[model samples]
Target: MATMPRLLFLVPVLVGLAAPPALAQSEPFRVVNRTTAPALALHAVRSGRGDWGGNLLNRGPLAPGAFFALRPSEGAGCSFDLRLVLQDGQEIVRRNTDICTDRTVVMTLSGAARPVVPAPDGKPTPLPAPAAATARPGVAPGARPNPQARASTGTGFVVGPDQVLTNHHVVEGCSRIFVRAADGRTLPVPQAPASDARRDLALVRAPGNPGPALAFRANPVRRGESVVTYGFPLAGLLSSGPTLTTGEVSALSGLADNQTQFQISAPVQQGNSGGPLLDRQGNVVGVIVSKLNAARIAQRTGDIPQNVNFAVKGTEALDFLRRNGVQPVLRESPGEERSAAEVGEQVHPSTVFIRCER
Candidate 1:
């Protein structure tokens, strides 16, 4: 019997962080297909804003190893999210990504290509394939894969048993959403409570029992205090578990002096949205939201800034939960600090992987 060709979803590891070329700045951003397989459709959108801008490659398929430029609307900023559907029906998505920073994104596909065939009705019919297969192959037959595939990923943490807190943008427009615990158990989330889109926070109930709920910090966050973030960035594609990065509270206000957020120096990636921003004592201070656009900033001031990321202030989340009639556990900041490793262990159980499907 002939084995089926393994479908590959090749997304650039750091395409979101790619620095746009300054000298040859053309359209704000564009995509280059470096993969061997044809991209059936491509869609781009401004992060945290509107719908998938529509197919940039027109109504036709993008040939293998071809590229095209994106024409975003007038107000579409440098930060964008992308979705590319392959000929095999497998989709590769990068969310809340900064494409304007990098003028060109050269996408690549791995493994063999399965050509989509035209049906008897004259419509193109893509070959049936696994939507997402990020887990490592081989093991006992029918054994659960370590890291399962997801349509799109975001970061969320346990606030109450069967209750998770995340950005509304993370789960917005999701027909189906699920939460994957640090232990690798996938829990379905059918619906979300009323969300505060202005503040970008939402709370959803988990279908299964969850780990220890994370505690929030009551007092205000100060500038220059050490902080850390934990979440699943790139999920099965990068690491099989949650990732951690450390930094300090760069500022008390968000972009444009927004009082509902904070500026941090910790590095954040596409999947880091909605993850917990914990202080040194492991208390939740904020939710990872977004980062600055290096390309846009460079266009404004002939210099490229680094490590300027933003998070929704924990107090905002508190108010939203209170409005929803759910009282979250709150704790005062600890006088003494714990080691980074200790903090990670204490909070890792409560951190979870959030997936959205439509």
Candidate 2:
């Protein structure tokens, strides 16, 4: 039987006007295809605010290293969101750039080449270079030391321009916390006054100057609903940033005690502590704290217990930040955000597989 090839999606945001004057010249952009299989077909859709318009389809297959040119439709002051859907129903959605005047934008589509593996002969083999490694700073020849190589894995996100939200256990006794952004920028977490220890949360100022603006969600989530979790699991084995995992709400209330925390069915591993749990719409729902271990409970109670996990509620985190005058931009979902497959190909480097050093 022939195995089906995986479909890839690329959501490229093109900003500019759709008028004749704007279409006269085009700006250049790049689209990288990060999949093992060749793209059988490519399609693009234009949308704005809440309206989705017509779609442009590419009939031919976009082989590895192929690039496509996107042209704007004729219209003045019309803003659009570009969505790319692959043959297998995967999508990449991005907000279109605003049109200042009539101008054209050019974009290039780059494909991910398949990796080369050697046969079982115990011989060294070569592999294709990965799509650019998320932007990393250059190290001098024979540099004395690299802090990140010896950093600890912890769950954290920007709460302010340079501030981060995480658990005290994550950075507990470490002399310093090494923070990395989704874009592959390395940063340092400066010591900040710890919050109420009962909550197990703390604030740390992210180094490297200013980073992405902090965002928080105010909507409440219910049980059995879909949710996504992000964090760095098995540190050192993986790079640091937002790692995405999907699961459903197992329980809304707490299992241990009211002071414990809410529980989610999401499967989180070691090094994932203190990561954010987001809703299907990409809103923060809670912060992953720990997984419910039946074995541990069984050992304590002399009986096997059910497995469960705990998370710090988003509402609680929001309240703490607000009362402390953190003032994060709290916003409700615009409607239904794009699905995982529709969002765009996620770069795995954005996620770091974490492992402890014994």
Candidate 3:
């Protein structure tokens, strides 16, 4: 490597869970995949309001040229922001389009790379995420947040009944921690959370059922294997509901060849830290941790990097949970891969958007 990319910084980010099974993955409009690449996920949130309702194509990915017909919901409004994540981790968004007036939305890949298949490769109901959160200098590993008046938001997944997992930065310096499930419920964190800032992880205990806990993957992630990220990224700007992105394990080490962390190409923005990184089988492989500081790197190198994010390894998260005396669900990779939408449905009830108020 000619020059080392310096920073692997952590920040707050999040996503909402999906409606329970009372509702299915069907939405109110038709989405046609007119691209050569398979679509890993599709989401439609009511244009300017509402979290991402659910993965519209939860049953499976939309094969190239396949069209999914959504019968209009009785009360879901007409306008929506339709986002599609392709297998190569490219997102094509059709924003604020009326599903009622334009009943069919056709999508085509926007000339992003369609690579050869590499071997690997939300929700709870939600409360409206804070209209905004205050940002500050990030906390260093094992360092507590300085007492302040700003709140940070991050994503967390259920590791067990009533146990939500997230990054310590999301909880540092907060007067209180609140978790929003997919079902429009706001859960209060009753006790002080168990945290390991060294690993950048925290476990918050909230009351009520958290649906099925996500299973951690039994094997190590392979370089170039496809992975999916589910979190609430840019909720203040994008939909607060679960946002999904797909990409491959770019490398097996982090900045400075950190073994406890891994490099991924999945796009993660502020408010996404602490979310789960899943394999094609919906097994939790890592925790969405941080991304390179692009502007700083750009100034140093005269070029900017894109989608260079990192995650804490699943084994590290598992160790943290066990140290906290929480038993987590674990699973081996199944023979088949699931569409990102399917993973969202299976784990939606288990994922929560975390908001920490200082």
Candidate 4:
């Protein structure tokens, strides 16, 4: 028989995601299914490599709320990509999963719905576009609200000498705008900011020379292409440094065919509003904007939305910069792909945390 691509198993629905309990090296990894449907099969392959292992479940179906332990290979890396098959024939694919770090793979309904095949080379495999969901009548679309009630924070990146770019709402109605670099140097915006409320982008100038400018890709971003972003989301709750998230271009347009934005699957929080969304080659492609209001959507549809986030397209941002007399840099062509961590290292110097004081 042909070698199975990887270990096969399944997890059921999990309501909320939390850090899993760590197990000793000798212990096996656990998978918890809390989904509505029974998991038919589960398979996994080491991220960035292609090879199959024996079934983690020993060829048994994973029922809802059921748990199982998967022993690790004798000498394998920590991260792996997962593929879970449900009884309804729908599947889910999650990439760069660190089984040891997470410990338990608690599957959610919406998270386990998107079916994708893992590419052997770590590239995104193309899938047909999913049909847009119709909203309930009279339910308004509220993009995740900016939490700038008193003093709020967001993220920005350097595009030109002494110039930083972020969302308009981040600095809107603020008495002061301050930025903190990765090295813990905090500086205030000295000059008036160039604002474009229509596009939800703002360019501010702070003291000191920037390390290096981030470049936008010359070519357009394709749907299903892998993307990464760096930002300081959830300012006080999370780390003082930038956090990185990776996903794929889920759609070419934002909600309701808004061409100015791109829908991405990379998770973003409130403070991510103005972060840079980069392609696999470390080129700017979009500005982290807003995520669909899951609470509102869940209230209306009874199903929670997952990773339904939006970003301002880099083309529009570049245009905004030029219209305001700032020349944004652009890469000549596409290059070899690199890991998200490598891209974040180069982006660290350009990205900063912005605090808006009203």
Candidate 5:
């Protein structure tokens, strides 16, 4: 799983200012869907109240290039909350409202908002290289098995000695989970109590292994900091033990749920969830949760930005694990945690290529 880079615009300043003293002026704007598909039954929701006050039902599906004007009542001008809600119950809320006058509120319904092309500098930037097979101190290397022979492979991390972290959906209904270490060892994951699905996380204990204590960091990460993600994507078609992807923190606290989480530009695929999102200092900052997919919105005729991935904040996960009585083997200091490049160098042999039957 590699991190993808994304470009986002800052909310206009006028959207956040206090309304004029006079009650005669009201905010005005337009809503537009700029994707290839139409947005079904879109509605504007007022912020804070969780209610839709405007009743401009898009009679026909809003085609890719179609837009509708939103006007405020006469003699009533103030900052108003607005959002786009689809018939399928998906919603995209705007954090700011700058409706001082007529404006073209163009919305991108599908596909990723275009990335900012880097300036053409001849200097070569180091792209993340593929994982190489190298043994870490005290950890042995493992062999690679045929990927096609496996039924399914789920990505996870060693949270404690002989303990792993993953998503319940990744191992749901499985009688046993195969645990692969970075040193090329494979062990069975024993049944462990799982947390509620509202958080979408799970924990498993490695079988018969008192492995090394894992490292953790609790500091909140600021947006635009360098981040590296590690996971087995596509069931190991990519390297088996922690494929590393690099990107920056795109956003924080912008999700629909308004939860404090990281919006990383990491390139992830199916089987990449439950992996660690590490900061530049090699400390775990968050857990990879979901990848942004534009095709799904296309199918539903709804608008959503693509390449937007979400992570569960590490602090939240740590709290959840503590509340659930799952104790992680935490390292004492920064010197104890291995760097991403160092971990990448030594983790190949300890991981196994998992193949499962459907």
Candidate 6:
């Protein structure tokens, strides 16, 4: 049987796009889905890469009438090849497109002419743009007020006697934020957090001390290395204390080969963000960031990828803290291996429950 063509390359695409009438000003750049069918998969790679990185659409397919921004790391290279898979299982390939220079890259199923808008001045807006219809990287379009005062929770860990580290998105628009220690005492986050939204990191101080801060590993993490994570997942719905889960380092890079993050096999959940990913010796290696949206991935691939989760590398977190004038307590991993229980007990005090109320 003849093999089906999975990809269809559109070569020599004329480089011009006209701003559509429905385009919002705050969404400075976007991938307008002008096609009638859903855009099933999206992939991008540097100009010369042999293969594309992880599918950028893992969050969910870009359905008809929707669009996505091309978010790259700060100062990353501009030239990239974009691959868009359509519902009919046909792929659209655009070669060496300069996302760094364009305001928006639109996807279409129809061959009808699209008005080429003038290129916006300067570099392209970053990908995976915030769900909010805004121009900022991580800021969502608008805050939906929780009038009923609903409670949402996530995880964090201590970096110093007073400073706790967590994901900025976890506490983005909170009217009040608090940290709960293992002892069940709730401490207030006295002031606003110092955050790096692009990196999704936040540094906030607790009134009193939580406990001995967890230490960062001095060396880089390797693939297949055993690791562990602790967090208060599904808080108020699960046990009151922190939960520990263990796995091995599946990959050195994260989704789309992001070097600043790790692809871990360790299981994580909504409440696991900002929790620590530790080595066998109880040294911090990374911070649990997110897990693949398995349901969505399965919808596209027809098979679920097992145990694919991600974490921010410790190096990135360390740099963020230092830039903010907070030096983390760094330590080297001991040669000795500790049991999961022992490591859990040693790090438990540093793990904290982060609560946000609007």
Q: Which candidate wins on lDDT?
A: 4
How much is 344 displaced in model 6, in angstroms? Answer: 0.4
Q: What is the TM-score of each candidate against the true structure?
A: 0.62, 0.51, 0.59, 0.58, 0.51, 0.61
TM-score-sorted candidate list, best first: 1, 6, 3, 4, 5, 2
Q: Which tens-of-lDDT digit does each residue in 1-358 have in candidate 3?
A: 0111111112212121211112322244577888877887777665544455556666678888887765544344344566676775555655545454345787765432223333333312222322222332332323333335344577889999889999865675455667888786777776667777667788888776655688999977789988999888765668979888999899988876889988999888877888999999999999988888776577668898887889999999999899888998888897688998898788788888877654
- C-alpha lDDT score of every prediction, in listed order: 0.70, 0.49, 0.70, 0.71, 0.52, 0.69
lDDT tens digits by residue: candidate 4, 134-245: 1111211222223543466788899998889998767654556677776777776765578776678888887765446788888978899899989988777788778999
Error of 2 at 112 (Å): 55
How does candidate 1 score on lDDT? 0.70
When summed lDDT is taken over every stretch of 10 residues in candidate 4, the lowest stretch is 11-20
Query: Which residue pairs come into collision in candidate 1?
Result: 20-101, 20-102, 20-103
Task: State the TM-score for model 1.
Answer: 0.62
Model 4 scores a C-alpha lDDT of 0.71
- Minimum summed lDDT over a 10-residue window in model 6 is located at 12-21
Give the Cα error of residue 166 in candidate 1, in Å.
Answer: 0.6
| Tens-digit lDDT track of model 5 for 1-358 | 1111121222221111111122233334567766565555444533234455533553556656777665555422233455554433334443233344225555653322222222368322223322221111121223333344324555676666556666644543333356666666666544433643445566666654524544567555678877777777764254544577778788885356547467778767666677777776666777777665455445456675656777777777787678767675443334344556865543333223222221
Report the candidate with higher lDDT, 1 versus 4: 4
Model 6 residue 5 lDDT score: 19
TM-score preference between candidates 4 and 5, better one: 4
Report clashes for each candidate as comma-separated counts. Answer: 3, 24, 21, 9, 29, 13
Candidate 1, residue 93: the lDDT equals 59
Query: 2 or 6, which is superior by lDDT?
Result: 6
